[model samples]
Target chain A: MAKVYNFSAGPAVLPHEVLAQAQSEMLDWHGSGMSVMEMSHRGKEFMEIIHDAEHDLRELMHVPAGYKVLFLQGGASMQFSMVPLNLLGDKQSVDIVNTGHWSKLAVKEARRYCHVNVVASSEDRNFAYVPAEDTWQRDPNAAYLHYTSNETIGGLQFPFVPADQGVPLVCDMSSDFLSREVDVSKFGLIYAGAQKNIGPSGLVVLLVREDLLGRARADLPTMLNYQTHAAADSMYNTPATYPIYIAGLVFKWLKQLGGVKGMESRNAEKAGLLYHAIEASEGFYHTHIDAPFRSRMNVVFRLKDDALEESFLMEARKNGLIQLKGHRVVGGMRASIYNAMPIEGVKALANFMQDFARQHG
Target chain B: MAKVYNFSAGPAVLPHEVLAQAQSEMLDWHGSGMSVMEMSHRGKEFMEIIHDAEHDLRELMHVPAGYKVLFLQGGASMQFSMVPLNLLGDKQSVDIVNTGHWSKLAVKEARRYCHVNVVASSEDRNFAYVPAEDTWQRDPNAAYLHYTSNETIGGLQFPFVPADQGVPLVCDMSSDFLSREVDVSKFGLIYAGAQKNIGPSGLVVLLVREDLLGRARADLPTMLNYQTHAAADSMYNTPATYPIYIAGLVFKWLKQLGGVKGMESRNAEKAGLLYHAIEASEGFYHTHIDAPFRSRMNVVFRLKDDALEESFLMEARKNGLIQLKGHRVVGGMRASIYNAMPIEGVKALANFMQDFARQHG
Candidate 1:
């Protein structure tokens, strides 16, 4: 089969080497005579796999000692509910920065449990830029401040983490989790869905501070409680075992590639290549995002001539670049070059974009 | 490496052919040039995959019309909360049958939401047998009746489905699902955690009647609401995509083997062979489970001389059979032979047991 580059937002592309290794170990993992999928979660083999995954992740991200890393299920959407359920101990409200689609979703779910304060929003400018920190309305008595570091569908990202405001800072870093280096001690909690920068869907990697544990209401479901998972080392029930195993392999891959620092350099270079192609096209291609807030993960753009959009996508697909269609809400083209999207794949898309523009310019 | 049979209670063995096909398509699926893991959940490729999975599941189980099949996460433990949260629309109490470890766990979670009436219990016999239906204490105003169909740890199963009591029947069939044919219309909801008899961990397959939708409290988290998933066909959130794909393959394998009827016969024969060996050992091996209530999925037994138990397990591992160790609470041996366990594996275990008894009796 011809090689094809997948630019899916997520359930997205993974490192080819990781997939190859998984295929090789599909029947028996480390001579255990049992596939990772078939082994008991309590068994020594799976225990070692999960432990090593957490250790590698902590090492790569410089996770602080006071935080507990939980490999949970139900994706980031589940976190929308859990954040409020666990964080709203005696507080009556939560401050949320609504940047775009995903941030608004967090606000929506949080509203179900507490008074949600939209501290600041970029909706006035169609969410193409981040709100300035000085212009924000602060909630003095809020339980915590929550924000999404990256808006996947809107192709926007926060230029900087919010300053701590006495309350805890919680971030939904689902799309840009391991793509760059960050000071882990700056935030109280951070979470990412594994499909984008890590491994597979059905697993969410959560890092919550120890102080935030044991605050959930007694009525909260056991599975929804972070304390339950933290106490049991995330083995409160049968976890998504195979997904965790795959995520472990991805962590190892990242470590070999110089951890998050190496990934950041490669990701910046890949994003630079595509953005450069769009900008160099002059009026032929355009992007609505502000330069400072543009995501290094999802690069969204459109052709100057609206009629050429379909032809651009169809021709790109023919050239082996697929899933470049932008989100339905923002119709155009989006090349989501996540961490696993190689530099060569990004270069191919950039070249394809430039050629398509020349033909229709 | 030589072949070995795994008898894990959950996160148990899967069909070899399914694993082989998954391995073969690890890098690229069919001609799509994208592994199923890399495909977008909303993309046409994954849309077809999820749709076919639902179709195959319905056909194999003879699922009644108006039943919404939801491929969800969070496992059966999640359902313990969802059951009462969604079903207790106007009622304040729910009737529950306490059969064993799994059932008691469900009861523990349900107590956080509503008044739980323990209608019947098998705890008197250490959960060795299912309580007689006639002895149940009826809750006339109960919203529904919930029970565990098979206890994986206690090695007990209900001899008959409880008769309808003017309310819905919600069953936790996590261990016994797809091992036999059942009348789907007898229950309003059925859920299985997919690891035991179907695919992998992290994905929970839920079947709920249409009438049960739209009953969850407005304050309930959207992710926990059945109406939210049913209205969107279980794509309300990014589901466990790869697990669903593997489960789809298992459904196909089940169909090729003549569906649940064929699997039921095979399970019975396998259980019979192991149970017969234990009974004919003349007190060398003992099982406390009543004959009528013995589970066909998990066959639990203890050596008459408890000190030799360690030797028994060590010798079994030497013979290429593994994971026969029982649950920690039950200090004995349990061989979980779900639908994927070939009869040959069961025969091997039976022969091993006889030889061990002859050498040590």
Candidate 2:
């Protein structure tokens, strides 16, 4: 089969080795005579898979003792509601830093449960950059401070984690999870959909500080309550078993390549190469995101001539690049170079960009 | 590899052919150069996969035009909460037929949102039988009548759908989903976690009558709201894409085996073979469930000697029949013979039971 570099944001590309291993084990996982999909979630075999996944993730992230890692379902969108339902407790409001698309959605969902205090917003500049942290208003009484670490759609990312407010810090890290190193102790909760730089869709890996567990509203749906999942080890109901298995395989892959630190360096190189190509295009290609806040995972840019954008994508596909079309809302091209994206794929895309621009310019 | 017959209750056995197809397509789906797991949910390729899956499922189940088929996450446990949250519009109560474990859990979740009027319960008999329909104490003012069509743990199934009680009917068909033919017009909603008779864990297939839409409580979490999924065709958020693809393959496999009607015949034959083995064992084996209510999907039985149960499971595994252990709540063995568990597997288990009893009885 012909191979291509897939750049779709979330439900995006996976490590080829992981897929190959999964393919080989599809019918009988480790001679258990059942596919991982067919194994009972409560069974010993699957328990090992999930346990290994969580253990490896903790080691990779240096997660502290008081943290609980939960493999859940319903994606980041589900977490939007869960964050407020679990963390709001008796608090009257939440503090939010609106970087872009994802943060806005988080704010919208949190508003249903509590007053959402907009501590800072970069929307005034069309979300092209992160707001200066010092200029942000602090809500000392807010239950927690929340932000999207990376906006997949707008190609914006926070270059620095906001300093801990007096309240707990929560983040929607769906796009950049595991792409870089972070201090796990800083966040009250961190959740990311598995589709990006992890495994497949339908699984969300959540890390919540233990002290924050029992604060969920009593009337919250049991499945939506963090305490329920935390208490049950994310098995209150059946988990996304196959996705978890895939994620475990990915963790192994990541570990072999030197964990988060290794990934951070590789991702930096890949993003730097692509950005250099774009800037060197000398206006043939342009990116709105400020350099300080530009997302290393999703590189969004537009062609100089609006009419040439379609041709750019078409030619990119011909050169074994696909799904490079940008979000419809963003109206350009977006090349998402998540951790799983090999540097070779990014190099090929960069070369193609220069060649396309040279011809079209 | 030593092939064993897997009898896991949920996340149970799958058709070998389906696993093979998925294995072959793991690297690149339909020459798209991306695994189905890696494809963007909104892309044409994945869209077609979901569309065909819904269409084929509708055709197989004979789902009426008035129903919307939703491929969702969070399992049937989530449905326990969603049902009451979505269906309890202006009504203050709902009727429930509590047969066993799953039924009791459904009632628990429903109680949080509405008064759960238990119309009938066989818990008096250790949940071994379905209660008589005429003795039901259904509330006339109930918003909907709900029931667990098959209790996976207790090995009890409703032989007949309850007669209408002047309200909409909702059923958790998780364990027996697609194992038998049913008139979709009879129920307001039917939901089943895919792990049993469909695909993998984490995906729940929900069939809701279109009229039941738009009745969710305004305060409900958007992900829990059926209207959000229905309006987006189950793509309100990133779906469990890989699981849905597997389910789609399973639908195709079921169709090849002649859809639900054919599955009904095959399942009945498989269950009949195992039940006959138990009955003919002459007190060597016992089953608590009444014959009429015995689940064709989960065949629960016990060895006459309690001490021999462990040995039975160990020996069964040696003979390549695995996961025969019953739920922890119900001691003994439960050989879940879902649609994918071949007749040969049942025959092997039957023969093994007879051999086991001959030596230990």
| Clash counts for the predictions, in order | 0, 0
DockQ of each: 0.86, 0.85
Question: Candidate 1: where are CA atoms >4 Å away?
Answer: none
**TM-score, prediction 1:** 0.99
| Candidate 2 deviant stretches above 4 angstroms | none
Task: Indicate the worst ten consecutive residues by lDDT in candidate 2 chain A.
Answer: A1-10
Question: Candidate 1's C-alpha lDDT?
Answer: 0.93
Model 2 Cα lDDT, one tens digit per residue, B198-227: 999989999999999999999899999999
- Candidate 2 share of real interface contacts: 0.84
User: What digit string (tens of lDDT, one per residue) describes model 1 on residues B49-95?
Assistant: 99999999999999989899999999999999998999999889999
TM-score (C-alpha, index-matched) for candidate 2? 0.99
Q: Which candidate number has the best DockQ?
A: 1
**Which 10 successive residues of model 1 chain B have the least lDDT summed?**
B158-167
**Per-model lDDT:** 0.93, 0.93
lDDT of model 1 at position A327: 90
- Name the Cα RMSD for model 2: 0.8
